[model samples]
Target chain A: MSWLTRAGAAAAVKRNRRAPLLILLLAAVFALAVPRPAPDHVPFGEQQNVETANPLLCVHTLLENEVQEAKIKRSLVLARELGATTIVQFFPWAYHEPSKGRFNWERADRILGHANRQGLQVIARLGLVPAWARPSGPDQPSTLNYLPAESFEDFARYAAAFARRYAEAVKALIIWNEPNLSFEWGYRQVDPAAYARLLRVSYEQVKAANPDMQVLAGALAPTLERRGSAAGLNELEYLSAMYRQGAGDVFDALAIHTYGFRDPPAAEPNRERLNFRRAELLREVMIAHGDGDKPAFITEFGWNDHPRWTSAVRPSQRSAYTIRAYDYAKSNWDWLESLCLWALRYPADLLSYPDNFTLVSADFSKKPIYFALQDYSRQRARSEALWLPPPLDG
Target chain B: MAAAAAGWLKRPIALGLAMLALGAIVAAALVAIIRHAAPPDVRTAFPAGEIVVGVDGSFPPFALDDGETLQGLDIDLARAIARDIDLPARFLNIGYYALHDALISGRVDLLISALRVDPARMDDLRYTASYFDNGFVLITDADDSDANFDALKEARIAYEYASSAESQIRDWEEDGRQLMRRPYELPQYALDALRLEQADAAIVDATTFRLYQSAHMDWSAKSEFISHDPYAIALRIDRVDAWKLVDSALAALKESGELAKIIDRWL
Candidate 1:
């Protein structure tokens, strides 16, 4: 217990007290010196310029849940190889904005970037409400497409954010798809006026964000139900109701889904039957409303070749009818902008009639219809060049 | 004196470090024991003597509801499997798309609604050996000499349009062989064409061919299987004991001739 022992203990205490501080300082220096690895660069910020002979040629691509970037790139590449200059891709709001006021554009950016890189114009459909945006009444179930009327402004903000972000790359945006169907309209009674109001709000917000962006409305599902029916209103009757509710002024163009269930494209258009020419009935509604000058975009249309589906046609018939539908639209419907088919491919097997609508299989194998469409597009391109007059000498 | 003081100070610090290391070692050992411990046996998750089976009741001849009771080949086969495994069968009608979800969510112990073995979903579920082959087969009037694709050259072959059979026929055509392909909207019509002497033979799936043969019983099928699509029972991958039981039951059914009798009842 002498003074020597006491001094040695005191010095040891001092050294030990400095150890933690010294270690922390060295760690901080190391951390600051070593830089973090950069994330893989995603190409963006470029304008998409697509050129093709057939302006009416387009296809819907399922890229929202496509996990692989290579698959997304391949889908767009194959579409372009098939002479399709435009594609209709779904950009679900719930997927992009999972929570309130927060946005994750990682997947959206990859899809849009790859699509733009492949020289394809994307007609982006925006819908699907996040859980937080849905209504919370005792009777209200949280559904993907259910958005309370109070959350319309929040939805508009999302649309505005999207339009502002992709303003350079994408020039067209569709607002809320297939509202005429009860299943699509949150399983509530189909209301054309409410949808028109939704479209008007979205159109104003999108235009404010990007004036150049074309706002598309009325991607209505084709049904034969009459007024007061529970399933849905007839698409023609729904369009008339939309015009009655002043939807004609809010949208730049009308977007219609023209699926020819079992009939060919040349099948006569009747209010009772669903056919490719049913698009004619939709156009007639626009003309009646004096909005005929605005072009119509057939955003979803095709024939399914499912062997078991009652509505499906034969595989060969599907291929033949699809090409004839394109030719019919080009020769007969001058007011049409594009005839994008139902789908190009899905990420996995839907195991239903819906899977049969795809031009390419889930495994990336091209179907016979895909080859048929490609050949048709090539021949049409050649015919178009032949029809073009020689450039006048300067 | 300084050295003695340092020694006294080091003793407590060293003691504290040792205690911390000991605590970490004890914590890691406890964690390992808990993690590697055997989980509760899923085989006994159901009722004491019953196995819950999920079936898509809409697929007729495989699984169907006659508005009161579920009856079909899949139902009888499931019953037979349950009997072999010494468990009572409780069938839960589920949609085709929700079958996998029902199995994974523990709503059902087994799925036997003519489930096809999907390689994509193999990681999530284990499948028993195939009990039925719904593959494409070549059928004739029991008097034809052409027994295979190579022999079917220059022969009129009838197939359902837009069907897997048509795709196979087209593949043969692509391989430099010519087939007088007559397409029908329904497989029954194709077989009818073959029976009516309009076609030399018919290429159709085994299911359609069996159903047609059940009614006619005069048509004979060639032994060559053109395509392979077998139906097997699907169980959750984590149910190790349950999978073993089902696999053994399927094998026993195959060995005892009960599987053939059950299939014959429907076919």
Candidate 2:
């Protein structure tokens, strides 16, 4: 009776072990026989065939404090979250040299230093048009045109010095911003010929300071048509006019500023000229000038989400439109080299005026449009141009 | 509570019968609530009279504080709707986000804050026919000169949380691209970043940028628009009647040429 009971218990243990083994074998067979279905394929609007570069999304930062410092960093962190890689900024001429010949690259150095440490590639535009550069008169805002021809050389010197000092950190130098636009040329007058000279001289100096560094031509503001005021010349006309005025071979890449409005980019009847298609027009002009082979970049282009402002679209619409426009721009990789949006955020008090221009609110609230960008940035890969053929359409 | 109790410890054979009874009771209660909430012809019953609609006055063309008064496209449109409904209209101003809270809390009967119909919001709000379209744009300092998207990888950008701009930015990042720069907010605090030179650029709407430019024409900072936006009126999601009433009112206003006049008055 004892042997029988022991044998029964032993058999029970053996059966328990066999049950587990059988279950394992069954599970393995089931896994092999029925694989999970592949994920559903939703077609992306368009696939990029050209190589795209990854650039950073940047915003202007005002020195306030550690909090402000953290605030700006948070903004950058958000941009990084959206896949921005480079920053385009400025070194204010007025702040750097309030007094003649005395320079304060300390502030500039700190800003640039932090950006570099954060792995941000900076493209500094060296044109604040200091008061010293202007002629003696009532104190007025300094613009690109205000700088005398002599001052252009001085600017070049300063630029050269800055580049030399930060050669390892700073990679690109844009001579000035929107020199073709009257506002940038100085509100007083529009002078392409003079501006060209400034470019020629400044480019030479900047290049001399850093041979390996790439210097971009100043961005040309997009305009409706050729007119009488300072911004009278459309982007293509202004660039061509500058080239006609002998602005050839001054810088490396041609920079442009493009914005699309309610109007279609294509021209129509009755409208003598249309600006909705300013970016395309500028590209056409680049080809006409035989500089079609040159790579083009759009420093700023975007729509507003302001509900109250006259020039703004409803905030809801702004989100939808931004996503579509960005996707379109990204899809058309052949026509664009690099496109940096106008901004990331603005001041709160200025929110009433600058309120609508941000992807997020001044207090760091996430807007619907910002989420759309985050989504796009997450899915998109920057296609690089290993070998791009010269402009064939041109 | 009764229905939940019936669901527990039930015999498999009786489970189906108990579930049916619970469903019938819940349905009966829901029907009773629905009937008591609003009248079927709520719009008609509220005799055409002057109705004051409260709005977040920050939005410009839609609603804004004109220094001393609240006036905007929506204000005028509301007036026109009132007139058609045989009533007068008064404007009450508030903040953008607060407008929604006000409406749901019965502080206001309607909300016109460029509301969009999103799935997540389907439960809390109902929208009328979208009257306008808007798009997001990229904002940068007027002086930025980069030519490619790749150039913006490391820059700082700022946006409001839960805003459309924030979503757009998130979508852009989801493509596995990384920016060296980040996003932030505030120009005055960061003006030093822009002026003394701390930050690179900012992203914002064209109108707000222009408003800032117009105010600070002398400040030397400027913004440009890069993108479109669409808009609609919103009501309490559960108030399907209110939604239909508002939608019909808007349509009637449009047909009577009253909408055009109102739009002209503000926009």
Candidate 3:
């Protein structure tokens, strides 16, 4: 070697020998400072050879002269294509039990009957009080919105009876759409304690009728604002109060409704604060009640076509959000078992109108949301194994 | 010779120890200075420990308040923001309008009240990214023929005070000037003004208007969100540091795909 290079090598060896302790200490610190991989989660639910992972899809029945069995079959097929193993169908009380005691299960029979045959699950939402249920007034107006305030018990009994008979075909029941809402509760005023009582009664009766039946409490519409005459409670406070009033143990799953403005699932620009991590909130309440591990069902959630629903997503956006939501729910398999869109099709009168919350047109033409679901279903069908993301922490 | 070499290594170890001690002292001093310099940006701007975020708990199929608890797009979004930053979110009973002041003077850190950021309230406060947006809609008793804006011009327009709808109406009035006659605020003093039929039509948010229209026979609706403004997280303009922190947190949220997940929970 050259004399200069040999001298340099000797100097480096001397420098290292002089600070051997320092070098060892630095190495120890570095070892401790390195990050470790996050822990993995255990999967839940029916992870067997299922074709679709998503368990909920939006389906609607347009007001018609006659209920079409063909349309029902198409919807089932559509739901199957949309990666949904479950379909949320509205059972408006006005149409079903038009009069007290007397029943007309014709529409439900067709819908639920068909859904059962297709091996798809059905979530039966029971609401829309009939004229006979309303309290008599001096200016006797026969509006279906009002229930015989006293007949709430009778209604529960009827509801339980309905659950008993259809327990085999349809077990999931979402009571009274958005009862926390003033308009949904007949727009006169809201009483949480009263609603809790109703929930307890219905829950008990349904459970008594069929213990195997899954009873999802009514999906509370989101309206934390208590402005003007349109007063409503925040979901957390409402649930807290419900639990306080002993409404916690009434149902199998907590049903929630979620929707965002025109932004995509990734970019919820305007209503970021309003967007709720659906399963997490319910889980929190459940934990508070010492039932943290209970599953949550998103009974009604979808983007609105309302070009101006203050924070509603656009038509294109609706599809993106829907897909992302499905993907997220699938990824986070536990806690969330179902997420039903608000609607499948708009009634003819509301078509082309704002706040258009539908997957299909009045004439049954599919929207982007329909196609998005279909694509997801196809993907799920192709995959041999399924993996979902870990549960979200708010 | 061995003794001399050992001494040399010992000297280097001593020197390294001294440098580390000096570095620790400098770090402590720097931390003290930073703590004193910033002093927690939200001390007065927003309530320090805990604050309430008012939301339309249930405007679902958009926002759903279970009468006591709040969950939905606005509710989930607020919770996520709260978690990222250091705020314990306790939703309050204060309605949509009451929360604005709460945000202004520390009663609350921010109003996740699903408020639309428009030109009218440019002076009130600062707004974060538009989380959600829907068009303005006119909801009326179904029999009422004045569903569209033109037909509803003659009908009395109803809207919440200080709401986005109020601001939009004001903007319209300003543009139209005297030619467009002003619509009455209705009921004189807000006792179920719309319910009392003081206004033939109410200009409400799309989700709400549609929900009412769908659920009630007395309601018919029409909406056009062509100029749909997005809902933004409202914060006081004076709290620059807190605002920056919130913005950064939100940016992180977007990057992590957490924001998208939040939207999925609600929408």
Candidate 4:
């Protein structure tokens, strides 16, 4: 009786351990044998193309935060229908590569696919470091924008991966956005030298992956901040600082953000005043630095029309000034490649003065400026270049 | 008989004192609920000995810097909250994009700008109860009692050509409702059309409609809210003590009717 009871207990214990192992084996085999289906989360409708009269009509779009693929497609359609031939979009590194060596390109694929289908030239802006790449600081946890020196290689690898995958649809890549801003640099002292190193690492990697990829850098914020100020150094001074840090060698083109705030398009450029023609002063900095041969892309620029914002203009004035700003860009700036507006639409209304910067509302309703830009885009011929030849300083 | 009379008197007097004590406790609790006591740790929340508010002073009637002075409904509201907290108020006129960042980085104590209560920002921020609803308002002539959003099957509607009102009307159209739309170049023009009987009803944001009405005091129109976009104050998630002070001050302002008076003075 004792022998039989002891034997049965041992057998039951052994069986309990073997049961989990058996189930795991079966699950592993099942996962391997059955091939997972490709992602078709959103229907890829008919292949479409755009027909636009103005090649310089470009708009920066914020579609990375879009929750629905239908909305992403609809936004790209709106941009193309508005006669914008190009769009600059942000593809956050934290969103795509959340961890080391692992990638989820579903969101990226849908956006690029829809955008390419719509026949729009896409310029990709990459930043927002992944959590694993950001080590906790001494005082507190690091923010998403905090990328350590050790993780620069990891971010470059991710950029190379992006470059290789979307090389067909994307021709240009912006290394970071508003790097001169202390907030964008993770609340630390904004260092152009550190940013130059980041641009170097990313440029080498992405160029190795796709040699033809245009490496753009420095979408500086148009602030009036001075040295030792916390907000950020102004863009004009920031550019000179960047050139001082040997940033000119690593990039193909420069990306600038010039906004018209309480100023007209024809306002004279100064070192202090932030205005639309401020791009001219920035170009002067480039020419002064001997990089005048390189083309520059105005990735983000526009006027706000909110009645209350001190930086805003009237709605009618906003519309007229935006169109005239585009015209001014075409007529004046010779090194300019594309003149993109600040945004097409945000996924949701910011419900502040920033809402007035968009050409379309969150509900997909068009603004009066959309019609203005559309008419302006149509009046010009399709074969026209962005700028007149021989580099006009005026 | 004298002893019995004394016992009866004692019972009633004891019961009367007990009732009075209970009434005092209830009154104190109510006062505690509405008029917040400054936290003992208030110094930790505001070591600067003052309340600093970050406002995007671009929009007028809310908060606008008129070159010589900063004045608006939000400016006065911030002042009243600081007065209730027994602290002097300081304001930083931040830009629209940098408002929340200023609050998070400890540069400002609270944000009193016309910021909507965004659920997305609830992770790092705690919002107080909304003070203003700048939602859309439907404007109809005072005599036109029958016109409203739901009943507008065949009425003529006018709104600013490309404003948020246009989006609402487009949504209504998508739901299979038919109405003749008269898009005006300005919100005031739409109101003018309603005044002239050129349109059956007009739509504009509450703030715009109020500002327009304040200018044209003689015009009478029936107004009803069709949407709600509430504006509230935001504080950092870690600043619970400071948040309580501001929330209680806002509630007191609401109760004392000073908040409405401030809004009326601006509108």
Each model's chain A TM-score: 0.85, 0.73, 0.75, 0.85
Give me the runs in candidate 3 sitting further than 4 Å from their true place.
A1-50, A53-66, A137-143, A227-229, A263-272, A276-279, A305-309, A352-355, A380-394, B1-267
If the candidates were sorted by their DockQ against the true structure, best first, what order would they fall in? 4, 2, 1, 3
Error of 3 at A122 (Å): 0.6
Candidate 1 residues lying further than 4 Å off, grouped into runs, are: A1-51, A135-140, A380-394, B1-217, B222-267
Model 2: per-residue lDDT, tens digit, B126-225? 7787654444445555556672345556565544334445555666678765643333333222333443344455455543444455555555554444
Error of 3 at A128 (Å): 1.8
A1-394 in candidate 1: lDDT tens per residue?
A: 2655777988878878998998999999998999977665544434545455677789999999887677788788889888898999999998989999899998888998899888888899999888788874324434566777888898999999999999987869999988887657765679998998899999899999999999999899887879997557988999999999988889999899989989988999998898899999899889998998999899999998865555778777888899899889989999989899989998875544467899887777677688778878777532321111211223
**Total colliding residue pairs, candidate 3:** 87
With candidate 4 superimposed using the best TM-score fit, by how many Å does residue B263's alpha carbon deviate from the native? Answer: 1.3
Docking class of 4: incorrect
> Taking the tens digit of each residue's C-alpha lDDT, what string does model 3 give over B10-99?
998999999999999999999989976764565443445654665544345445666565567667766777787767777754444345
| lDDT of candidate 2 over A1-394, digit per residue (tens) | 3656888988988988899999999999999999887653222222212111333233333332223445555655555565566566667776777777898876676666556655656667677667777764413323334566778877787788778888987777777777655545554356778878888887788778788777777587765546575334666667778878777688777776765444332323122453334666666766787877777666666666544444455444565565565555566536565666666665342324345566666667755566656656666633632111221221
Report lDDT (Cα) of residue A60, candidate 4: 91
- Which residue segments of model 2 deviate by more than 4 Å? A1-67, A139-145, A263-277, A380-394, B1-267
True contacts kept of 4: 0.24
Roughly what TM-score does model 3 have, to 2 decimal places? Answer: 0.49
Cα-lDDT of candidate 4:
0.86
For model 3, state the Cα shift of residue A102 in Å: 1.9
Q: lDDT tens string, model 1, B1-267?
A: 999999999999999999999999999999879754744243563445688999888666888876699989999999998887777999987656456756754557889987778787888789999999987888876666645656788788887655567767777889888888877756677887777777777888787788888898655655457878888999878776787778878999999999999999998
Residue B49 of model 2 has an lDDT of: 39
Give lDDT tens digits, candidate 4, residues B1-267. Answer: 999999999999999999999999999999887655535356766779999999877778788987678889999999999999899999988777777767766678999988889999999899999999999999988876677667788788888777788888888999999988888766777887787777899998899889988998888888999999999999988888888888888999999999999999999
Give the TM-score of each candidate. Answer: 0.63, 0.49, 0.49, 0.82
Docking verdict class for candidate 1: incorrect
Taken over the whole model, the C-alpha lDDT of each candidate is 0.81, 0.59, 0.61, 0.86
